[model samples]
Target: MISSTPTTVTDRDFATEVLSANQPVLVYFWASWCGPCRLMSPILDKLAAEYGDHLKIVKMEVDPNPESVAVYQVEGVPAFRLFKAGEVVESSEGAISQQKLQSLIAPHLAAPN
Candidate 1:
């Protein structure tokens, strides 16, 4: 069964986990200290569940994953980047509603089987 939980990603395995993923990936860049980041957790969880099979959702803690944070130029928590075929196809930052998050992924998700 596919897991809805967002896989924890770090600079160490970012390339393999996100960049090389078979499906499109939505990378959530968050920091523990950010209140907004905490608020986004459940919304992200929901998205992970709905799109788990068609899209990959991964979380990267900014503090420990400097390489990716820097590479992605994520200066704030709760930033999102959607990647397809090893390229960024869409991106957004800040705390956003579930509907907004869905819009970000909807374009990339494969039609349900």
Candidate 2:
């Protein structure tokens, strides 16, 4: 379960990892009690591994990361924000399809050589 998965952005590392990082970052804002959030976990995990070389994927709990959630203006659970060069370039909210989610990040991915 992604709940058990670690290596995500904490309030402590958000600045360096997402805001100042050299690569694109995908932030999944979710809550433990949210059903849709739970459902989106595995899909994100798969995409994380698939896109690891070009993009960084991280999970942020809405319950514990109130600052980030509010800062991003997330109105719903299972929110995804794609950040590049320290700015949000794209965003989506809800339990969306894997294809739709992939489409969201595709443009941000580095082209294969």
Candidate 3:
């Protein structure tokens, strides 16, 4: 059995967990039927653990969270929304490689002074 830290978000918690999070949060919008979404899960889990301090990774199933699905204007599965300061600053759709995901979050990591 594998344990993961990425909080599985629901429509009810989206506002507080993703939108109002103090740090950057990566909201992974996916569904059970989406093969690509399944493929990206482990990568996200790994990234979440490694960047836990700087980023918060969460997943919300569109099928069950229709409200949030419509709110985000997500048209595709395996969609990603990067929220900073309560707003979406970056996003991607479809299956994305780990390298691409890393690049997306790398800039948000702390810069040594």
Candidate 4:
């Protein structure tokens, strides 16, 4: 099991937790029935634990949170969106390698402030 304490985001909590976050936020848009989403869950959990302080990893169930999906234009499951200072800086869809995920997040990790 993944040991990271990933925040579960919903329609009610999206703006406060993600858009208004002080630190960078990694939002994973997923659905329970999506196979790839299930596969990436463990990896996301690991990332959350490893980068707990510098980043906030959140998981949103697309079916229940359509507003977020519409706002972010999430067309598929297992979508990953990185937000910095309340704006979406990067996004990815479908399955992705752990290395790619790390690479995409490297810049935010390197931000001085």
Candidate 5:
């Protein structure tokens, strides 16, 4: 089974863990000091549990992962990018509600077996 917990990624392993993932990957760009990011984590954790079999949720701290931040154009905290087939298919910035976040990825998730 896929993990129910959100995985952490780094610039060094981003390509392998996210870009090359077999399923769609939701990449969350956040920082330690960002309150909004902290608020968003629980929502992500919930989604990770619900969608783990069909999707991969990953977190990348922007402060320590500058290469990924610059490459992905993440200029602010609480940015999200959904990668499918090795390319980004959806993206969002700033605070987002759980419903909106689900809608953003629902269309991309695999159907239940």
Candidate 6:
């Protein structure tokens, strides 16, 4: 089994964890039945492990968290939203290449505080 650090987020924790976090965060919106979501899990896991300090990666289930779903306007599964200093900095939907994921998050990673 792929070993990735798991940080589960919900409506109650969304604001504090995703928005108010001191570190850049990657919030993954997905469902258990989503094929693309499953495919991307391993990649996300690897990223979480590799960038544990600089980035905070959290997985959220949309079905169970209506508040987060509506709040983020997540209309589809396998959505990735990057947050920096309590603001949404980037987002992507559907299947994403590992390279693309890195590219999208690189700016936030490199940005000076």
Best candidate, TM-score:
5
- Taking the tens digit of each residue's C-alpha lDDT, what string does model 5 give over 1-113? 68999999999999999988999999999999999999999999999999998999999999989998998899788999999999999999999999999999999988898
Candidate 6: residue 1 lDDT (0-100) = 29
Tell me which of candidates 2 and 5 scores higher on lDDT: 5
What shift in Å separates residue 50 of candidate 3 from its native position after superposition?
A: 0.9
TM-score, predicted candidate 3 vs. hidden true structure:
0.91
Model 3 per-residue lDDT tens digits across residues 1-113: 12247899899988988888888888999999999988999998898778876788898999989998898899999999998898888889999999999898788756634
The segments of candidate 5 whose C-alpha lies over 4 angstroms from its true place after superposition are: none
Using lDDT as the measure, the top candidate is 5
Residue 46 in model 6: lDDT: 85
**What tens-digit string does per-residue lDDT give for candidate 2 at 7-97?**
4777777888789878888899888899998889999888877877778888888877778888899899989999999999999999998
Residue pairs with backbone atoms closer than 3 Å in model 6 (clashes):
19-86
RMSD versus native structure for model 5: 0.8
Alpha-carbon deviation at 109 in model 5, angstroms: 1.3
- Alpha-carbon lDDT, every model: 0.90, 0.84, 0.86, 0.89, 0.95, 0.87
TM-score of each: 0.96, 0.91, 0.91, 0.92, 0.97, 0.91
Model 1 per-residue lDDT at 21: 85
Q: Write down the TM-score for model 6.
A: 0.91
- Candidate 4: regions farther than 4 A off: 1-3, 111-113
Sort by lDDT, best first: what order? Answer: 5, 1, 4, 6, 3, 2
